[model samples]
Target chain A: MRLFKRQNNVLPGFGLTLGFTIFYLSVIVLIPLSALVFRTSGLTWGEFVTTVTAPRVLASYKVTFGSAMIAALINSVFGVLVAWVLVRYRFPGRRIVDALVDLPFALPTAVAGITLATIYSPNGWVGRFLEPHGIKVAFTPVGIVLAMTFIGLPFVVRTVQPVIEEIEIELEEAASCLGANRWQTLQLVIFPMLLPSILTGFALSFARAVGEYGSIIFIAGNMPMVSEITPLLIITKLEQFDYRGATAIACVMLLTSFSMLLVINLLQKWSRRYAD
Target chain B: MSAPVTSIPTSNGSKKRTQTEPAAVRWLLISIALVFLTLFLALPLFAVFTQAFEKGLTVHLEALKEPDTLSSIKLTLITAAVTVPLNLFFGVTAAWAIAKFSFPGKNLLITLIDLPFSVSPVISGLIYVLIFGLQGWLGPWLQAHDIRIVFAVPGIILATIFVTFPFVARELIPLMEAQGKEEEEAALVLGASGLQTFFRVTLPNVKWGIIYGVILCNARAMGEFGAVSVVSGHIRGMTNTVPLHVEILYNEYNYTAAFAVASLLAFLALITLAVKTVAEWKVRQQLDNN
Candidate 1:
């Protein structure tokens, strides 16, 4: 296509930088990730199916995907609330609260798990309040959901906050002038504009939660079929020296997550068409 | 509409939200935000510190002084020191190429750089093990040569690097893209050397973005657990990082000790957050100036 490529070259080293970028990306990320699929390819069809669809592995998929979905949904709601607050309202300690939104990103997953597990246990600070009401959170699917929600919050909030800030007050005024009440204006006017980003945030949070391991394992009770997650299961297979099985499971997750994200990306592109 | 809609007081509330939100609704939103943050964000952090000091400061201090704990701290420091700079190099190089040139597969390159972010952390570590572990592709070769990659410091560094691959590049790509090549083109026209142009022009433009990215990458490299755990074999005082050490202490029913080691990481998180906020503020200030 480039019969005569433009030579508006700046300071040189384009070759050097591009070469290094490809080399480092190849060695560290591409090759290693490809190795998983390559190793999985060694499996027979029956072997692959059985390994990925084994009862326990299947259960883990259910737990991981189900909890992640619930967590993403919860985050979608609250994360928007938080973003709304940050963008629209200015209360005292707003900066501190804003900074706190990112704590999960910096905090070690292991630390988050242990701390959350302790705090939500039956004898925990908040747990003590809820225990008498028969509301259990730690060491169940709910605990998994809670952990996922915590870690996923930053994603939704960060993504949506900027979009909210971009929303014009004139648009809301226009909606109200069209005989829409405040609730109707927010629902029909503001929410549609924010939907694409909220969906992106939800997809991101869901993806993270699906692959989460260190945090979930502690509060998860690690009950094999009941509450165990896929990542931990992959670890268990490795610990048991089941390399083939481990790679097989890892391959499934890799493909599904990649395809899912690809679809979401396309959907986002489609959604942005409405924004214009 | 501006003239006192239905007895809503204008005194207590800022005039900022009068057009967008009712005063009562604003208060409600703020209250929910506060309580939700207190429950989800504040308490867990508080728990980490309060539990660390539950058995008094002496015991907590002793936990940090434990040989394995101290070693874990040392290993974590070394891991971050090595990984952050290496990744930063890749980030700057990658950003330079992608931002300055319009090439085919450019988007694909960006996605590949971010591959580890979407992939499971366990899988991130597992991929390295598949290449270099005892039963890995190079396992026999590594064993014969007595070269340990997985289950050692090198593996930890690799996983940390993989997980943090996108941070600096992602930060700078958009920044450099926005800044464009006009400045660099001018520097070149002025007869500056390539590296000279980069240092004097490109680097200065993206300095804040790079700092923000580097800080985030370092925080992640230090706090990464699942990937490092998968590759690390959890050898005490050897491969067990601070996170794994916290796990070990917790498994041993040493709550105070676990939380003590964890507090160090929590402290790291706080410091990272603070610096990040400052960097963000600087970025915002620069944006406003422009």
Candidate 2:
């Protein structure tokens, strides 16, 4: 690489541009997050632990993290199928189906929650059918899963769709020609190739689900220890004027999410290298 | 080509026949997806419309005319107007710098920009309150200056900005990076000043991406609930946004009013979808031409 050669003449001075970028991001993002950590540090160690580990907070952690994991798992399977259908086939209304896969991305989370709650409430159209069968959705843990699944599905689908499109059909055909059965062909050829991208999709969906608040709150019924999510807990603490408590809980969540994401990124890198 | 086989093995023949199975199964798959989406997405939206009409148009209209509902809409639009433009400027400048240069902490800055996307909105709202609330670190200073941030419009706007800031920047980074420095270099070589070349060449190239990001930011800002709710204090007709307004009505057992306002926001989202489609189509056209 020509270290200092001026390209045709574009923007001069790479040093100047890089400085601006660092200063801009530092001021806007890093400072604010660091301030959050600094504020939470005001609490004593015992207070910090108690604030984040209270019975109600523990219940919220279970609901938020547990439902998010389950929802991400469900999305990983179905989102793969949705992406496969969009990429591998040419059908009537294909464009519309492709577009709708992005609906969750475009729809406002609040409106999505409100709509889901309305449709799943006892007398709501779909809920009416389920109620006869004794299945309650809205205001339950089940509804939290549904809301998370609704918003998280697109993350998995969109992430995997491009990788699916890029994969060559010849690999599957080659596997079949080698006397492999359909299941074998999928397992030996396609699945290995897709594993890394699928996991990327899963990680993205999981992260989104864990952080989700608006869409779940409307449908979650928000009963203590049952339907309340971590985000809701943080909000509840804030409303109650528990500033130290809110910051402490938020710090725990931030650290946990960051570590999980770090682990997922490592897994993704290993899988990609393995496939290559 | 090899000579035709004297007799084809049954198993091999069946394998060949199954090659076309995917074509046949494709329709079955499409139908299943269509039904699933209708049940989950379309039906729920339909439920909102039906609930709005259940009390007759007169009541629905009355709900719309309510002062609180109107104020919520106004406040939401004003916040979107303020936040989106500011983010657009910041997004473009940051994206430009990131794409055009490399330095220490480049990757870290990218991750920082995406932090809001990964962090929960609930936490985002709480962070702002923890800073500006009456008991917050800056509370005394803000009070001394006769400025109130928490439970006010400024708090709502700040929360909205935090969550939506990443949208436009995320959209433009990859697009701008891929376009690279060739055209920009050519313009610069021709004596086009830095700002002039950017406006004349670069801006046209990235405008569609910017528009798409703005559309997304606007949609999220208008319908933001968790963050705003945490900070707004739910002051009806004062600090309430539409989503908060709907929640209040729903809490009061006013289902008609709740769904009516929700329907309005849903309609606005539909318009957003339309704008997004146009923006995407424009970008696609540009890509094809290039």
Candidate 3:
């Protein structure tokens, strides 16, 4: 490798820039993240299992993962619809609608939390009508789902939108001329091409929702076993000065993040393969 | 032997043969999208403002003028001020290295840069606490030195930086990668120094991408809640940022006050979105020209 290394390049400062990048990355991200692993290592296997698998913590896992799944699924459907409409059709106020897709990303999570809680709290705007029909949103797992869906909305729409735009209309026209109906064209011709990106978007939305905290906590009602999410559970542990327990649970959650990183890598490869 | 399909349009509706779905289908899809967006995106934004003004504009104004609220705003500003520039420097350097170089483990480095995005914000904040809190790795040393990192202004800044670590770099990497090293190579061959070439050629090429990244990074830095909250200790009038302040107010049953402070952030979000839209348009225009 050293023998093959080229030193003939004209560009300079590679050493300075790369050194700074590695040093900064190590100090800011790598070292701190390793602290989680180091701290978790202090626990015995028994202790780790007990901390992560406690009934309350287990419930939070269920709540967090379940609601995030539901939320990601919801975003996958509606986000694709939004992207499809935004790309394929022109309606009034389209630019405004397009810009608004990113509101959840730009809006502070706390503001989203309070606003969502207020709007869905039985006596609030949409909640008032739903309450009459025996539906309660705020202070429930459903509210957690709502918040997650809101935060994850832009991921799917943004990801799928470009892919949708890249889809050639001639393919659809060919399908139609071949006597396949609209639905057949979409299902047979288009959906396969879009699948990889759709999965990527779904995975991204799910990952973001899984890690979400500020927005879900306010709306989640934070009942010990019912609506409490894992992030909130970690906060609860930290508040109680249960540092060991907090990191233990955080270690498990961190595993999820690492796995997400892997999944993202694989998805990128899959999408690249399709692109080629 | 095939029938002439061109004549089929006469039997179909007069809406011209297009690859798109029929008009009725289009209207249905558009309506669904509009309603869904309104319910999820538009109304909550509307709610933040309406709730803020529900107790009259005077109360909303008073909430904004509240001492704690003002202090939180100050802290938020300070945090963003410090965090954005630091991350901006890292972003440019990292992008410069990764985009222009082809060393081994380059892909791994790129992925590592994005590590914070996948991690939970609580964990992002917690990692520092684990290092600097009373029970952490440097806890005794920090306490002895009277240096505070976690649960203070420094902690807040650290967490914001972590959460926003990848934004600028991520924006520039792809952009610079696509722009290729030709321009900088040209500048160098013309006797320009490395720094000179960077400032004159590379920076201009990625200026819009940098702007887009900085705007986003700044917005997240100021608006970050979960990470900042985990590290902030939520000490009102001191460590609490704007989002945390809103949380405290809302939890204390100060709905009007909470939404009032929240309206300001909502405004920030709107401004960020507006800038983002304009930046995106500018970039698109540049692309079209190219």
Candidate 4:
């Protein structure tokens, strides 16, 4: 009877829920990703390499990964500062400031792109002032970075803000009482504790920026081999009915992105162990 | 005080001065952040309104009067109206299953739910196209049934559903986990049927989270561009969403009309933010009372 019970029932019929979950995921996510991989498999190895490693494609990889990294790094620094302020202070208009952090979340990416483009165009308000100084913004790689930073900043801020709020102030006070200078206290005491979450935030922001399209297209100007991004290239390929070419490039991007995320996850696990 | 001026060492004075420095520095940092936000976020938003009305307020007013613009607005509202409710049901149910139950593959299912969050909207749309497009796996089957999905309203709805699937679910999971299952178990033990317990107990508890998620989902659905653009086929009056319409006008070099329609979408975003604020406030209030 015990053997039969053990065989028949472990955790109240796991078979049913497991089956449902697998079915749901297969239908929604796994199958679609496999289709992308399957589609790309139709290409020869030489053809796949040629498709993904062309000069224009290489330039896009540089721009996408390079700009995303820079933007994520920028957000990590500033996001921490912004989060620190929001958590540590009680100030007038704090509510408003906090609310504004979410604007990027709510604003439509296309609208954000248009607005950023207009604001940074040569004849527009901010652009008019900067143009006199020969600082071009709109239709430049710099503009791409700016747009990515705009969209990615909120992710970092939101992720880090709660963590900062939960950090006890007494730890900082204790470090100070132990004769640690302010900079020393910050670098040695607070930063190490917050490092993992910050890294996670950076990874999330970087991933988001790499895949961002709507907010970037207008600002990037889509100049081939220059401001053009990988996502834009994919769109172009699709428009031209180059299905095999698009999938080939997409596979490369997907593989690179998956690896990067995996490394970041590993780092997060390491940090958790160290903290413990 | 006179005695202190002489008695206080220079080191203490420096320490005091340095302490005040952070306050001043804090103010400076805050000002810089505020100024940047005002310029980048606030001004550009204000510019949308200004540009819309610049060619005489009458021009924009007349543009709003256009039946096409009104229809686009109506279409966007209807889509949001339909999609938000459907997603709410899915999100809440899924969150309940994942959070309250100790099921196999629960963690994997949670990750699957969040997959839409990480995937690009462009890809999200393409997945549907790959499934329902003329060359898709289901294309023949759907065609045999005379079901039109691609370049049609159904395509847009499916795309919206894909992108916004995580919002309500993401919102509810944490809330439900925090609330725990004790209350639901009590209701179950009290002889309430499953459906009755869900309505009388679970529904009330998760209402705010659901509302928050709905607002967010509606906002994104209304403003969704990349996914909708691919499947829309840009059929001006029929399949044109507000965002797509804005793009069409911009492409046609009708700058005034483009900004006008863009401003309308922006207004919808503003309304969403307002609702979000209220929902957040209600959640905070409930938390306090609890």
Candidate 5:
């Protein structure tokens, strides 16, 4: 046999497509992103540490990640309810309702931010009702969570909606015949099948909410060490020409989100296998 | 589903309405869904139009006609026009490679391509600044050449492109993979050149997916804010995109104009969603016929 056997692949355009793919990816995505990491590499270890661990940046991290998790958890529960209703029921304007679920995906985040802020402000519609009752939402961490929840809802609803459609009602009936009530049937039969998707939705929502800036900034009050988000802080750093500081904080966000993405991929794989 | 297909068809307006669940439970679920959408989606949407027209139709019209606002609109359209086509090309190229070929590091390549999705928009712009800003790696070289990127239209376009890079590829990848290489191979074996096979056979098959991807790409490109803001330097009328213009208007307490500008963006979103719904319906129809 020849030392190098040239096996012919049946598919065409392998060379041309692959060449364009690499060249395009490198120019647009890979190269630019590598520039980010390379820029960060210019910092010394101490400078990087001090830059990242600044008190305000650390505080922003808490608000950003904390509110993101809280909002995603909220979406995880309510989004399922929304998805369940959409999948299970027929009603007037159902198409409009289904389309409306993607409002956050379509609307600009800054618009969402300002609109949410306006309605939730003390003088505004919903906030007026709450204000007399000694409850405030806008300019608080609550507003951050609200904005996050608003933007994050679609991730959960869209993710779980398809899974709900795929869910076989026979299994629910089977559970019922075995004397399980609706709640128990959902808890056991339905919930287990839905858990993987719910988690995936939660992760997606968290990923989006954590990076959210335009929506949250307007509603969040942007108070130092309180409502400040990591993204805003990064922008603040860049504005002040603190390039090293900005890149370091950005690097942290990049690493954290990358890990979250990894977990999401694994969960998706598990869901696929379990579904089969 | 493993359920009795004969019992009912899936999707809207099926005999599946009120499926064995109790009336009260169904009503409750419906109420929750309605109330939630009303509060979160409908309220904000209503508020935008109401606040925009709060002063009246004339004021809103005047707001849209303001010089800075006009420029912002122009800038947004230009940005989307540039980034969407660029990303469309990149997306189709990447999807062609990743979907149609078996290669080493394919998964890693895909992950890299998808990297910007999870990236913070602020970071998306910040990275470019690092590459092309003052004191950046190429900053000195670029300055020597007297080329401006960081605080210019080019920077805004770059940031928009970065944020929206994955849309077309994301749409096309799964569609192409599902369609597989059979039709493509048959065309090739019949003596069509590679480009001819692609243009005639593969492109036609994936046309809807491409349009769907372009719609999504254009939406995000026009709507991007945080990244573009970082690089844009907020130079009014010069570099401010619509989202940034909205922020400026609002911050100046120009509430009516702010909402009016926002209404324009909302209009874009509405059209994007409407077109998307029609595209999806068409896709479903095609799937059924096939």
Candidate 6:
């Protein structure tokens, strides 16, 4: 059985391009990533388990995955609404609002971290108001969620926007002709059509939020067992020169995120098939 | 920008309504979207600029001119300079192979290209650290050679490259794929050389995608923090990129100076968005004409 057998296409340089692609990817991505696995392999199984499942590490996992889920959930509902508004409504400054959705993507994570820290710090602009109500945003788990939400904002809107635009008006029209109210038509017809994209967007956002570091650290207050995230724990271990501990935690995060991405890929493939 | 609002016609009755929402409902949804964007997206951006100039214009200018800030900015520019071209070349080549050809394990190849995207940025930096750090794979050789990577400019550049690796290729693949190989085939039939066919036919077709990709890649390359932070040992004027410098200043309670640097980054983000919007419009126009 042959691997990399090329079909009889007129495109020249397939070998050159493919070979270059593989070389670059291996040097830049694959080989380095496998370093994590190799380094982690130096540890005994019991030591690896203890390192990864320590109370502090476990708590960081909770804070990380929990906040990512909450943020992605929030993004889903609002993202769909935002997509609906952008595609269906004719509002002034609509194009600018559309552009602003990509701000999270364009802005650096560190800038986002500090700016959010400033805005949500007790004496800061938005935070001052919330402070009076006994609500603290910065330096808490809530702050972590807020940062993750900001980081993950564009994923759902960008994912669902095109899907919403592609929804045939005829389906809605048919639903309307069948004596469905606006709410009913939206719930039964439009929502079902949007489910797959919404799921894709949610998974994407969740995955991104889980891996996020820069934006959350400033706001999370770095209180281990309470708000410190998994990435930060890895950083902490690295700082202490505990390469073994760091690689163990990094490996866990990597495997989890990789599987999540694989699931998202399958979901997208299934959705495409379902669409066809 | 005002596309006429067309309400689907329906018999005016309490039981039946048009496809469009009532004006009140329409305005409510629009208001929700506008308010959400303003609170979440617009407000933090406003805060960046406001905080930067809080100590007045001269102070802001002085902060930017600080030797450390200047060096950090220089380092960021240098990183983007090296990273973007490498990725741009890789993106074009990868897209040419994956988009234009049918071969074995193409999906797997695409997945491998996208692998960096899903990895935590810190891990992206760590993987390199594992290779170049003092106890890492090449650490002994590198140390024996008196070479620095993990805590130096080279490590920062590698981390940025790793994080921004997928941007260009991701943007170009679907585009070149959609554009098929027909044009290249036609150019070849006319006796164009392979390079000539690529330059004349394929490059122009995907030029906007390339620009858009580069714009995004440059933004992230310059703005990357988590990965660069791990690799950069916070050497104030040496390894510190702009984002890392912002962290150092902010951590030191130099709010005004930190915001000053961050505002420049924010400004870059805005410019990136504007250029991206135009590139997307150009691409759409190209598609419509085709």
Write down the TM-score of every candidate.
0.95, 0.91, 0.96, 0.89, 0.95, 0.96
Give the winner by DockQ: 6
Error of 3 at B220 (Å): 0.5
* Predicted structure 3: lDDT: 0.91
Q: Model 6 clash pairs?
A: none
Which pairs of residues have clashing backbones in candidate 1?
none
Cα miss at A3, model 4 (Å)?
Answer: 20
Best by lDDT: 6
Instruction: Name the better of 4 and 5 by lDDT.
Output: 5
Give the CAPRI class of candidate 6. Answer: medium
lDDT of 2 by residue, B1-290 (tens): 32222231232243444222354466787677677667766676677788877899999999999999999999998999999987887788888888886657877777778877777778778777777887777889999999989899999998898889899989888888878878888897787888888899999998899899999999889888877887898898999999889889887989899889988887877788778888988887876567
Q: After superposition, how far is residue A90 of candidate 4 from its true place, in Å?
A: 3.0
Per-residue lDDT over A15-50 for candidate 3, one digit per residue giving the tens place of the 0 to 100 score: 999999999999999999999999999999999999
Q: Tell me which of candidates 1 and 3 scores higher on lDDT.
A: 3
Candidate 5 lDDT by residue in tens digits, A56-88: 989999999999999999999899999988887
Which stretches of model 1 miss by more than 4 angstroms?
A: A1-6, B1-18
lDDT tens digits, residue span A1-276, model 4: 363366532112234444554565566567876777777787899999999999999999998889899989988888887887766655678777777777777888878888788889999888899999999889998889888888888788887776665556566667777888777887897788888889888998998898888888888888988999998887788788786777788788777667656765676676568555
lDDT of 1 at A194: 92
All candidates: TM-score of chain A:
0.95, 0.93, 0.96, 0.91, 0.95, 0.96
DockQ for each of the predicted structures, in order? Answer: 0.58, 0.44, 0.59, 0.31, 0.59, 0.61
**lDDT tens digits, residues A1-276, model 1?**
131254656457888999999999999889898999999999999999999999999999999999999999999999999999987766778899999999999999999999999999999999889899999899889999999999999999998987787776777778877888888888888898999989999999999999998888889898989999999999999999999999999999999789867966775786568656
For every candidate in turn, the CA RMSD to the true structure comes to 3.7, 5.1, 4.1, 6.1, 2.8, 3.6
True contacts kept of each: 0.76, 0.42, 0.81, 0.21, 0.64, 0.79
Residues forming the 10-long window of minimal summed lDDT in candidate 6 chain A: A1-10
